[model samples]
Target: MSTPSHAAATAPRRRNETVIVFALSLAAMVVSMMQTLPVPILGLIRTDLGTSTAGVSWVTTATLLSAAVFTPLLGRFGDQHGKKPTLVAVLGVMVAGSVIAALATSLPLLILGRVLQGAATAIFPLALSVLREEVRPQKLPGAMALVSGTLAFGSGLALVATGLLTSGSDADYRDAFWMATGFAVLALLAVALLVPAPRHKTGGRTDFLGALTLGTALLLLLLPISQGHEWGWASPRTLGGFAGAAVMTAVWVLVERKVDEPLVDMRMFVHRPVLMANLAGILVGFGMFANFLGVSYLVQMPEALTGYGFDASILRASVQFLLPGAIISLLASPLGGRLVSRRGPRAALGLAAVLGAVGFAWLALDHRHSASVIGAGLVVGAAVSFGYAAMPAVIMASVPHHQSGIANGINSISRSTGSAIGSAVVTTILASRTLDHLPPGVPPLPAESGFTLTFGIGAAAFALVAVISRFGLRGGHTTVAAAEPAAADHSGRPTDKAVRTDTADAAV
Candidate 1:
């Protein structure tokens, strides 16, 4: 059924497919690392940049805002234009951002660099879109699970790497950016060489007005959530930002309803399964971040005085408390993929909630010792892996294959939003409660009760996600539904030559 030349061409493509998955998975891990890489060294960055604490906070805030805005837009663009080019472009920009941050001598320069790096948030959904086109449906679940699992791996790796790199107070910290640069360079090269061009393009026009309004709305909403602690929760700026976001969102909705080709299709967005999955993303994200920030801070509490913590430095905290959980999450991903394949995402989500609740409850009752904290984290880490793996599976199964980019991008935003909220909540609770008996000028640490309360809240969040997943996701293999007939002639579609080759392989 195949000529010698055709067989040769098909053989190379089949070989390249495995390479493509490996490259994208590594890229996903690296980009996730970039998201949390700056948190541990914030004090050093503030001092080095010679900026006030509030000013230096922008280093993280800038990336969050940029990610929130660009992720979905770029995803939609990739669907309409070309995914491989878009992926390469996004990785290239991340590389450039890493360089900018590495050389940055001022706060604005560093913030600018982080903003550019934020563009890579779009990569996750675009990677998913690519996988949809290149990998077969039966293999899709496993490949996606690997990529999704890397997110947890990257987060943990970032903490350990940050600790190792910034061991001394005088450590340049710029070395971290250089590390990001190296990873970006590798990911960029891998994507360029191994990833085949998109197999389908939406071939539609951009909706500039919808994009502008949505961007404005997200910017306004995320600002108060990320900065509201400093601005005062009830301050005019915070409240006004929320109000403006509400107004802009209403307008954006109306505009999307009327647009010929909106930035996001409201119909796909409002589907029961899609809406439920996005909501689950927010809840699960809240629980996972609470675990990460809470444990990192908890271990750093001064054991000599706090009576509950090890009084470890950032490096020790990362090693003792964070590293184990991340490694567990990495392992849990493939297990999760098997579960998803056999049972379904709903089961996976339900298990995540049960495990998270148990982990948080364990910490809530017995967190005085470091082993207890780390032990609880190991369980919760698996929960996070399952949750992350399920979210995209739930999403991809519900939407047309072509919309995977934008749909997953929006889902990513929901998680980002939840992380912001979790950070703000934990920070406020820790700061608001303090130890009464202290030496003069000794900084306050969160009361043990505060952490207990936070963990209890995290348990509740996870439990809610379980409930949502049970009711929200549609029950069926929608894989066939995702492959629309219109995709047959798109630039990303398989040629007759390639189709015949695929058929022959299937027969064999």
Candidate 2:
């Protein structure tokens, strides 16, 4: 069969576009659920597999690392080929992985399954790219917000499902994987039936070398972080891994500048808004995960073991935090869209950054007291949701449509890396400090202290993001207003009146 021509392939139809958005949103929700499903079942997985804590931990780490390595590569592929096929392929991989995990007899096999499962993470960026092309300019912001919010909702639901499904039995972890498998199947079917074939295709060589360099660098960095304590942090292996990661990252930067089709367009970093958004994404990601991790420990800590002592089971604990965070994310996402529409992406982003910083600070300060801790978490969750949802809007508004996928993939990688670093840093601190203080049979206190310290660090990081968002993003408004009209014209919606009004106002 002959390849479809670019214009004929991408020509937007109103009805098909809406269906595509819905399909993509559904896919995003399915993919995001993978991130949180293992949380409630971590202890059970360890016990059943007869795995060391470090070995079992790889189940989650492997998935994040795989997603970090694959997301941009898949996004670039979608840009060159088409989104529908790429998304379907990823979903299929996730289903296969879920099935493998459900049937696994060993921790190694389960880790392999998790790696395969992580491929679905790319579906989120691919969906965003598809929506950027299919949706109208006016509806784009809201659609993007809805899509992003689905990620939070899915994650929360997955946690709840894990808790409910795994409550009384050690075998229940398998049920969680089955649930994921079912979601994947549903997403794949929806995509096949609803998402129309592409009308346009872009031709570009896959940046295989760039992908290798990035993948290698990420592996080097993440391996040590995920396994350093198990391997002995002071050991030669750990030091070597960190050294290799740094060198590889430097080499990748050099190689990226020379390549015709770099996996990530490094030049995009020069754009003030893009740079600021990415930086903010990193900080927001760090803070978000740190908070989640800390709260997980807090909720799971037995009443005899901790302050604000409650005897809630894992299921109840997961549900309590999950519901509030999900609700806040759901509410904030649409509000971010409205804010972007009224003021600009910069304003919305700034507001999110400030809110995140404040919320995290509140959580840190109120560590020992009050039910307001949950409210603080909700605020932080909402702020992160708003920031993340607004970022795609800014990137899409700033860049060309064809490059949206790669742009978003790079953004995704930043978030992933941030999370990896946060997990490593937080866990390391907790482990190191607690090593000395465990009273004979008593559980650890350093873990709890580390949780507090990590949140404090996260709060500081987000505060910095707030500063950058306020200053770094201001330049984008003028640039966007200037570029948006031309982009609209190319999309066959001339912004003549808006341009004229903007120009007149500027002159005055």
Candidate 3:
């Protein structure tokens, strides 16, 4: 009779938890949608802004760089000061960026807005950290998966939404930016009204020096990779940037080692599980972006001329090739959570790597037909959901609970770095390889072999992730021998009572 009473009492709490997760997930989706809102409309942007193709590419390049710079910085701040305020600040910035982009009449202004919008990258990791504080441990994995999967889902939806808004060839891309602004505004209100402020705070000093060094190093390293094709791979500018990156890396390591409370803990970061998780994040991210950019490009190639393409509009590419993948990603998210809760993150990652490996391998081998391309994309998108879901599990399991924000932030940066690399490589491959024969009046087209090579490389990266997860994920789910669960009121700082209660319930 008492047990029944306890269960009845807890029912409402569970219902509230469900509502909270739904709200947070919605906010996360809006942030992710903004990140990819401009992807399908770059050509239109080029024409609208009267910019050269090379110049307009900065819209994406600048966003990548800005995301890399801000995610870790703001994440660390959120961990020390507070997450809700930090998240609200980030959302506010995104809204401003979207508005700026919507009203921009010049290329530089649009790029500036994109740079600000890039801060939304921090939103995904922060949402996961908040889930840890708000949801019960038993429910945490599933809640985290929902949030993580939304990233892939929102990105795909963004493409589809952009296509709808700019359906006509002559439709201005600025409408897409306005749509982004609306989503951002909605997200801001949702966070402010629905989600309560953070009760957990791991008070610490902001590592300004460490952040500067890391940010500068990341910028130096990524600028060349993103723009190397235009500048010439062997040009002085690219080489100099790489050299500067190398020097900055050495300096950043020294600074981190000497600081009492470093921006990033050197010892924890290099722990086998944490190190491997970050590495796998890079490889998985590479495969994800490669699949996304490659599929969209392949379908849009004019079928009449290229023969291999579907002659699809941006709308068709998103609907026919991308939507199935997004749907599969949604289906895979909870499944991934179940796998993580049962066998562990290692198993989930292994599954992701296998799916990614097989997906890209099939794409490389049998891409002659348009249907094959769509099928491959569906598989790869599901793989991304698995990978994204598992990644936070690995990070959360390995790092101390208090460090979740900064730790996940670093992991997010790794993914962003991998995306830039994948984008650069795919661009280079397609640009370098060209069809051997073409009619006099026909414009140039990429050889089919370029796509084959890109998929093969993506397959190789995922295969490598499998090997890392298998060997390097030992003991990731277990606490360190000397450390017991810490006590605090906020969910981020779980008390002994809270831990035992969740563990007991899970055992039931």
Candidate 4:
């Protein structure tokens, strides 16, 4: 149906789109790897840096707090200025941070490096915006799913890689950071070379006040969530953190309502579908971290002392137990994309909920066998991929093209917050119930019942995901629709090709 010139033009465009997607996926994977890289080597880090457990905890905590502060602000910046520049700058920061982390001699320097790496969380939302600009409507869901799947895949892969690298007696934690640096360099090059400039930038003033208040609220909430195990649930510091978060959250809302160009729109934030998607993000995030921590701890328990478990070394647990699920998640992503494209994100979310519940139920009831645990983890991994695939669709469909990056950024924050809560909950639950009658001078080990209870709690979280999908997300499915005639490009000139994709309902 096309002339030779038309066909030739289309082929390269398609190739370019493919490159863009690949680059974005790499960047997204790197962001997830940053979160999990130091996890398996925290012990080594503490020993090498001569820091206490509480001091080493900052390696992870610094990244979380940094992401909470920077994701939305940078996301909005990309939306207003340009995605490509923002992405390149973020990746640059990640590379520098990785280098510093790899070379650090003290805990403070390592934490500073992690803080910069954490700012790259903005890459995910900015990547999504780039997809919206370039990919065709028919192929968009698949592209988004592939990139989203990398989050789960990268998370598990980082654990495995860290285990392998640190398996020797003389292993240095800095080796993990070197690996991160290599990946960050690759991602930076791929993105800078392949991705095109933005065509739909919406110039606006940054809302510094709203950004500050929101960042403070998240910091307060996450500080308690991450540290409650050390602080004690009833401690004044923990209680004060919760109260402070609540008050700052109220202040953030007020600031957003008053700002002319807000960091987050109050109405859109409260929209039923968006609200439900965020709720699902939290539950899914919780289940994801819970699965990782609970399974890792359970399998590594010494069988002789615990009366259960496989006594898996960190390497064996990461490679033999967790790697399969991570691979399955990557493999299932295209299917999830197809599911989202055909059945809508709501249906995909429902399927994720069912699968997650089933997977956790299997683990809770029959975790004694390796086959059962691996098979169950595979299912949960796929469920996470599906949930990740569906969330961006809901967010992209609910917000205008101009607000896509910031909106998705907010959703990403919700998931991170949930992950922090999940880690804290697991720590508290396992510590609360340990084996009785342990030998003198032997460290406490979690009872088998603790594993069961943890999995049960994970199942409940997924069940909540189902409830949200069924009751909260209502109305017809919507994908990216063509931009209205009045839509303007970065130059303030009308553009026919730009899309403003949002869900439409007579009532909603």
Candidate 5:
């Protein structure tokens, strides 16, 4: 075994480092909560804004679009400079956005604020980067799991809070933004008070060209997909957006090949673990968000019209989902860390994928009953937390410490892209099936059917992911080899002699 180094011993001795980790982690959780705040109130916002259901869906689409665009860019900046300043900058922008959203009267302005909020969500990934840099290896697994799980837990909490606050007679949808503002303020203060300065300063040229190209490409791609139905999917504007996205992505590939300091390292795509992990991330994201979309509709369906007997108000419906998801998140986060330590990332990921598939399948069958719904939600949430935690661990293990930020940024982007696709797919199905005009007191069976089918589809997707993870993800323990040549054999043994001996015994 390799000896524990002096650097590892000395790193945690600094008082400010501890504070920084705690503070940044908490801030990241708060930022994560903002993403889910509007989810519980999506229906309310739709009614209040007097917008089409499809149009109201864009509130989520807008935030995801901005998040997908900015996550990699901000992460790259953090890697090139330092996480502290980047985090603070993101928090400040988010605060401004929250204030704007709180005061907004128009749907367009609300979307603009959401866009800014999404941009600021990059702080979660940046915090992970910081943790990787500052925390000791021994402590990393748990810390990383906590960071990953917080996204789910915090979002659940935010949704629950929104449900409770908005259920009151005095509160409106705008109160959610104000709540976000308060969270942002607390995050900002925490960052200011607790985060430590980086020990090593970053030395690299900024890849402005790459950033611009990628940004343009993502925007072009996301715009059409996000608004295609509203704009007439086959209309000239939608077609033009698709064409522009294709051209920009093609150019981006060429630009990345030539740049010394590429914003995203295209070569990471070739690494088996990184590539497979990202693919898994995408599928998992799709599966996870599809569940969210399906459950939202399922809970809102009137009891007299549906399989379940409980007729819950909007607030109660939100809680029914939030409580189970939060409990599962809390349970799965630490469990993921333990699993990673024992079985390696590939095994952990495979297990998570399998669990997700089972969860979704269970829901498809059991959604008729309220208890079953909660149980299925818990299972799905646990699977998601596990998968989420394992993904970052896989990426961090596969790349150099310096490139962790970019690798994670890419992972985040993959998840966001998957989420966007999930949203679009679910929305399209519901829209295509549901009639534009509903007669008074008449229910939307087509919409309800669409959601059921979507959940089934998500279950199938997760099943495929589980199979792929089992076979496709290799080099689990050996992931550290990709970054550090000396640490190639991560079997925890010291030398190649030990590796050969173990191989020989296994061959026998």
Candidate 6:
């Protein structure tokens, strides 16, 4: 239907959009890599730094808490100021963090670097916001799927790379951080050059008080979730952490309600579809970490000692057992996007839930063989890809253009919380009961039953996702034009005659 001139103009625009998607996807992948890079090398780090297990655990915990604090705040900042500038600043910080991590000799210094890198978690939501502005509605789902897939792929890539880099007898864990530094720098350059500047801005004063309360609440909640096993689940610190989180959450809600311009709008925050999307995020997040940790640990168990494992080295666990799933996740992205485009996000999410449950059930029932572990992991990887594609779509469909960054940011935090819980649950289950009748001087290994229990729990989480998709999602689609609210100025007054046409209002 387009004329020659229109077609010619469209070609370049399409190319530009493609480049933009690539840059953002790369940035997202880098952030994901940062999160998982320490997983394979934690033991090495402990030895090098002479830290106890509890001390090394903080390396990962610091990043999680930092992400919880920064993601929503930076997301909202982008909405108010400008997404591109905010993205640039965040990436710059990531580069600095990676450099410091690469050079660090002390655990505290390394943890500081990780905290800075964790702030880059904001990149994912900001990328989604940019896609909304620059890409046509028809193309958005596919682009989002591609970007979302990178999170899983990058995570696996980190494990593989870390294993490979630290495989030698004298290898240093710092090598992995150096690799991250290179990738972060590349991502920074790509985003700077390729991504277009923001086309929409919601100028407003940041609610610093709201950010503080919410950040504190999340910190209190996640601290115990990540460290509960070490702290003893029934310890005063753990119980107090939960109690404080509940109190802080109540105070945050009250603060939000009273503010003229709040950090989060209570109406939108409580919207059924958005709420359901967040719930799905948590479950999906939990399932994801469960698969990663449960499989990695199970496979790497010394077969001679355990009599049930593959005796995989860290490298083998990463390359043989995990890399295939990551590749499948990347391959599934386009398919997931197609599903979202044709059947709506609810349908895509339902597919994710089905595949995830099946995958975990497979792992639970038959995990002795490499074929079983790899096959089940592939299915779960695809499920993760689909779930990732659908989540941002639900958010974009539910909220106005201006609120996209923070809305997606909140969803991101939900997923992180889920991942923390998944990791904790898996750790606790595996450590709960060690194998009986082990040889003298043998380290205590988890019983085979522990892996089965962990996978069963993962299956339950995904099954819950299916329940949410069926009961909680209604009117969950929107055309590109309708996604935008009525055009408004910095003061939030209408600046154009366009009506708010998004159908997600009733459903969300």
Cα RMSD, model 5: 4.9
User: How many clashes show up per model?
Assistant: 3, 5, 0, 0, 0, 0
Ranking by lDDT: 6, 4, 1, 3, 2, 5
lDDT of each candidate versus the true structure: 0.83, 0.75, 0.82, 0.89, 0.74, 0.90
- Which candidate model has the greater TM-score, 2 or 3? 3
lDDT of 4 by residue, 1-508 (tens): 8999999999998999899999999999999999989999999999999999889999999999999999999999999999999999999999999999999999999999999999999999999989988998788888999999999999999999999999998999999999999999999999999999888878979999999999999999999899989888889999999999999999999999887888988766876767888999999999889989888998899888888899999999999888898888889889989988877787788889999999999999999999999999999999999999999988777666777888889999999998998999998999999999789999888999999999999999999998877777765554544232224444322233322333553121
lDDT for each residue of candidate 2 in 1-508, tens digit (9 for 90 to 100): 5356755665546567677778888888888789878977888999888988877889998998899789989988998898888888998999899999989989989998899989788988888877766676666777788888787777777887888898884455788988888988999999889987765466778988998898899889888876776787889999999999999989988888888767776655445556767787787778777777777666666545454324557777677765688667877888877766655666666777777778778877776543756787888888878877777776766555556777788787777777777777777777776535445888565545665677788778877876776676554442222223223333322233322212222210
Q: Residue 193 in model 6: shift from native, Å?
A: 0.4
Is 3 or 5 the stronger prediction by lDDT? 3
| Residues 158-244, model 3: lDDT tens digits | 989999999985798999999999988888887787776787888978998999999999999999999999999999999999999
What lDDT does candidate 2 reach at residue 44?
90
Ranking by TM-score: 6, 4, 3, 1, 2, 5
lDDT of 4 at 454: 95
Model 5 agreement with the true structure over 20-44: per-residue lDDT tens digits: 6668767867877777789878777
Model 1 has an lDDT value of 0.83
Clash pairs of candidate 3? none
Q: C-alpha displacement of 102 in model 2, angstroms?
A: 1.0
Alpha-carbon TM-score of each model against the true structure: 0.92, 0.88, 0.92, 0.95, 0.87, 0.95
lDDT of 6 by residue, 276-358 (tens): 98999999999999999999999999888888999899999999999999999999998988887777788888999999999
- For each candidate in turn, give its C-alpha RMSD to the true structure in angstroms: 5.5, 6.0, 4.2, 3.4, 4.9, 3.0
- Tens digit per residue, CA lDDT, model 1, 1-508: 9999999987876777688889889889988888899989898898888899899888888988999999999999999999999999999999999999999999989999999998898999999888878876666667788898898889889889988999985797898888889988999998998888777777978877988898899999999999999999999999999999999999999999898778877877886667888998888778878998998888888877777787789999888899999999989988887777666677778888889989999988988877789899999999989888878877777666567788899999999888888888888888888788877889777888888888989999988886776555534322222233212233222222211111211110
Q: Score residue 241 of candidate 2 by CA lDDT.
A: 95
Off by over 4 Å in 3: 1-5, 475-508
* Model 5 TM: 0.87
